[model samples]
Target: MTDLHRLSIREITEGLSQAKFSSRELTEHYLKRIATLDGRVQSFVTVTPEQALAQADAADAALKSGTAGILTGVPIAHKDIFCTSGIKTTAGSKMLENFISPYDATVVAKGKVAGLVTLGKVNMDEFAMGSTSESSYFGATKNPWALDHVPGGSSGGSAAAVAADLAPFATGTDTGGSIRQPASFCGLTGLKPTYGRVSRFGMIAYASSLDQGGPMARSAEDCAYLMNVMAGHDAKDSTSIEKEADDYVANLNATAVKGLRIGIPKQYFNVAGLDAEVKARVEESLKKLQEMGATLVEIDLNMTESYVPTYYLIAPAEASSNLSRYDGVRYGYRCENPVDLTDLYKRSRSEGFGAEVQRRILIGTYALSAGYYDAYYVKAQKVRRLIQQDFLKAFESVDVIAAPSAPTTAYKIGASLDPVEMYLGDIYTIAVNLAGLPAINAPVGFDQDNLPVGLQLIGNYWSESQLLSVVHQYQQATDWHTQRAAIAEEKA
Candidate 1:
């Protein structure tokens, strides 16, 4: 039989329905792929083979009983940030290294209800702080295209897993550029839905206001399937949107790109450090979209350069507040033999959290400090509103905005030693989160290093269905989404 790992969600569901192969067989195929190839990519921190097979068995029974959901029996993995009941849900931090969640994250519970088999928890940045996956207490997830290069963080593990075909698709949380950046580096289609479109309860908070969970997969259609199960109103999560769940799959292949007004922010292309080749690839994709009848219009977003600073300030401020619970007094890592309460607090946090996480916490604490709150945090919020206003005005004349997902392709694992340079990796994607809009990063082409480049499509709030429709049309016209990394090819 053809390599089952390569088949998309649609194919897998159809195959199961036709009795061509049981869900158990499909699950086993992916489990085998993970066993053989995950070592090279280091994409997973944990692999629940037993749980996966059991879930597969249940999915098969559901299929036989004719009670299957669209994603029933389709295997997928969750980023470690989301709490998985009975599974260790470390957010790639030493603090939660052994914290097994008592309840499933709303996203996890919903996916399970849809019968999507859980593979395991994928790795991520410690508290989702870093721009590259390197900050994980579990070593950085390597890019499948090149073992030495970094996979974009903080959803790097999910991106690598899907890119290597270890899982058909995986959950990813975008705080700043977490999901989209890694997807760009790993050659996957990643969507960061508008804030609160997907519930945040049980998904470990990075910057509570900015964090959003979405899908990372080979095609937009797969994301649509996952979104159908993921998006909904969750009473448990106050931030969850109360709107009715969308039929993303039915509207995915929208008629065509005709009359789609795609806005290109002049500031994005003129950014100081954007790589020439990256610019070329993004422009080429735009040209292709134009050929498909979409019109490209140049627009100005004056707040473009402020995204990095504004996001860094606001995200860290929220993170400082959210992560305070990890002190030695409660759950998570506790210091042994503490001489005093203050010592216990200091040492446990110092020892448990990674360097990057601590750095952000410090920055956040300082930003939210009594003397500086108005100067830093409050001002950042104002700038954020200005950024949102910019998008609102742009969307008045355009349907979506287009840009390169990242400034360049994946860099060498430790090449960006300077924190400033590392933060700049998110220059292109941070704005979407700051504005609380939906954006997608779709694989466009390869760089000279054979690393994939992605073209980002940013849509107005609650426009995920429209964004997926546009991406589906683009993927149908191009073969970039079909290309696989050499490691995956070799294994196949």
Candidate 2:
């Protein structure tokens, strides 16, 4: 029998509605799975069993009263960066290890209002730096599919938890492929909505322009359902788009791929270091899309190669500014001995941040320094606009662009000793964040090692419904999303 914990959110909801299971039973099923598997996976930084059960009970009451919302009673986890009231909100950093938010982020607050049970905060890259979860001060998250491999990050924990059935689905943020890369590595579906599509009122910022939250799940439909609840305008966040969110799942049945122009950027395919197996799988995926009646068009995104340099400059420049608030004087970690205020700032930050984080902060500080601002930071922002223009030009001819989510599948933990090599893993994904466009990563096929591979689908701004529709149709024709890791099953 399939474990209830392994079921999708839609399946769980149906089971509850039919009285086949109760909310408490479903919540317990996941909590038990976390207990059994998370010790090895290290996917969760905190697991709120008490709060989850309490919320589950209330969900049951709401169901009895016929007042439950779409996500009511669904047990889900949040990326540690999304602050949760009273729950330890560590951005996988020792600096704020004990810091608890007095209130929830707009996303968490909205999820609570929608009646989604909180499973607790999953681990992430410290301060949301690094492509792999290895930068986490808490420790790296193991990919459930391959114990030696890493679950791609900074949303590694959220992706691994869902893939391992520790949570039905979870929330994640993408500031340069954090959500999509991990989702690809874990064989889960992840969506990064357009900039300003989701409120960032309480999400720990890495780069304000690039950061945005979205959903990760076993299927695109589930992602759509979760996105429906998490997306909306928030008065608290000035960047939040003040528009009504449509029912994203309502159009999943519209599988009309006819006349849908799918752009394949020649630059992505020509990028060096792409694995042969991954390339084959991506080509096969394109063939499948063609078979589904979508028209394939070769397109050029000339600025693609500039993505890495542009991102390294822009993200860290913003990160240095955003992370400046972690001084011990405020809410987070503090140094014990204080000779002066300067010592407090230096010691607190030095003691708090991980190696990769400090590197970026230094890079950012240098870029934003008075002497270098016009040469590096300003120039990078200009290149960012050019990259955005590249996508805009492509979208003028195509409805969506499809490519490999990562150059390859999950890499063994500590495989890339050089930070530059690690940054290259996200080469295909960072462009979307740089452009502030919505993107989705969906399972394509397994590689030679039998590990899953993902295909990235980039959509025009606010075209999430269209993107989900494309993935939903592809999923209906393929069983890739239905596959699970043998290790996760064994642990479950």
Candidate 3:
């Protein structure tokens, strides 16, 4: 039998049910892989080897007693942004470097109750601010595929970990294409669930309205498996929807694309910076969907041009407010020199945050300041509403919207220096978040450089199952999702 590292959560669960493999053995395999390869990838911030083994033992006992859940004994990784009780939960920022949460985030708590073993905490951009993992305070996470290139951010570590087989799957928070972009670059399937679909009780807030947590894995079916555990309601999160949770994996075999309306937004195709190869690959994916009985429709999302600027304004504005809790007096980092309270606040923040974080804080402060509120913040909110309205109208006529997840594939480290240029990479994905819609990124093909390209699928609010079904159908017909990074395969 193949090692547990090559099997999906579903496969591992089935094997565990039949007593073919002990949960402890599966957990040990992954822990050993992380210890061997993670040094080069730096995907994890904290590896909970002891906790994972303990949970695996408990899961093994449960299976022996005929008491096991769907995800029982599966090894998974959590993004550092999600808080875990008694575990160091750093949002990849110096501000919360040593902060330990007293309670688990709703997602973590739910995964634990479902009997899943947590591998560790994956790294991310500081406060989930950048498009590349380079913004991490700990260190930049090297792309497992090409060490010189970056696995996209702020969920770069999550994507890289799953792509590299460091973990079976990982959880990630997407504010503006964080999960999808990284998944695309890493050749994995990632879903940014509809806003408010998953509880955010202990997810360090990046942008209150845009931040969302979801699953990233080697395939769409694996993503669905993890989503089944992560998606649900929690009274702790005010924004959590009260709708009954559905089994996401139940519909993965539904390949009935007949009569499915797939909208091709013209604005996404015409973006100035989009690479020709990416466009060609997405078009090929569209052709494949059409062959599967999907009908492609041309649609216009006229407000697309303003997505980047509007997102920059709204996300940072909310981020500034959310990050204000990190003063020296609180849980995280404290400055040594402080003659008075004012000096304490200034020095603490000045030394704690990175350049990009500070820039956003300043921009957010300026935008929300007196006199500028109506001009900047209010206008951005209005634009956000318009983006949502556009999606609503489009969905009335189409089942899904498709586009390139990112303008290109994994870029070289430090390829994008200007913050604006980095933000523009998420143009196609941020709008879906702003509209509170579910979106997934699935590998479609490779570019001229052999880097993987991803196709973005956007579904209406609460339509994650539908999106997952479509992606699973596509993966069944294509080999892109199964294609591993050369370095990863070599290491395996």
The candidate that wins on lDDT is: 1
Q: Mark the 10 consecutive residues where model 2 has the least summed lDDT.
A: 1-10
- Score residue 459 of candidate 2 by CA lDDT: 94
**Candidates ranked by lDDT, best first?**
1, 2, 3
Model 3 C-alpha lDDT per residue in residues 1-492, reported as the tens digit of each score:
435677877788899999899999989888988998888899999999999999999999999998888788999999999999989999999998999999999999999999999999999999999888999999999888888889999999999898888899999999889999999999899999999899888999989988999999989899998889889888988899999877889878664677799999998899999999999999999999999899999998989988988988898899889889888996789899799999999999999999999999889988999999999999999999998898899988999999999998889987755877888888888998889899999998888777889999999988898999998988889999888876566443
Instruction: Give candidate 3's whole-model lDDT.
Output: 0.90
**Candidate 1, residue 443: lDDT:** 95
The lDDT for every candidate, in the order shown, is: 0.92, 0.90, 0.90
Taking all chains together, the TM-score of candidate 3 against the true structure is: 0.98
**1-492 per-residue lDDT for model 1 (tens digits):** 548877888998899889899989988888888888888899999999999999999999999999998778989999999999999999999999999999999999999999999999999889899878899998989999999998889999999999888899999999888999999999999999998899999999988889999999999998999999889888998888888877999998754699899999999999888999999999999999999999999999999889989988999999999999999896999989999999999999999999999999999999999999999999999999999999999999999999999999999998846887888878889989988899999999998889999999999989999999999989999999989998777553
Alpha-carbon runs more than 4 Å astray in model 1: none
**1-492 per-residue lDDT for model 2 (tens digits):** 348976777888888777688899888888888888889899999999999999999999998899988678999999999989999999999988998999999999999998999988998989888777998988899999987899989999999999888998999999999989999999999999999999999898899999999999999999988998988889999999998886898977664787789999999998898988988998999899999899999999999889999999999999999989988898888999889999999999999888988999899999999989999999999999999999999999999999899998898998855989888888999999988899999999898888889999999988888889999999989999989987567645
RMSD of model 2, in Å?
A: 1.1
| Model 2 C-alpha lDDT versus the unseen true structure | 0.90
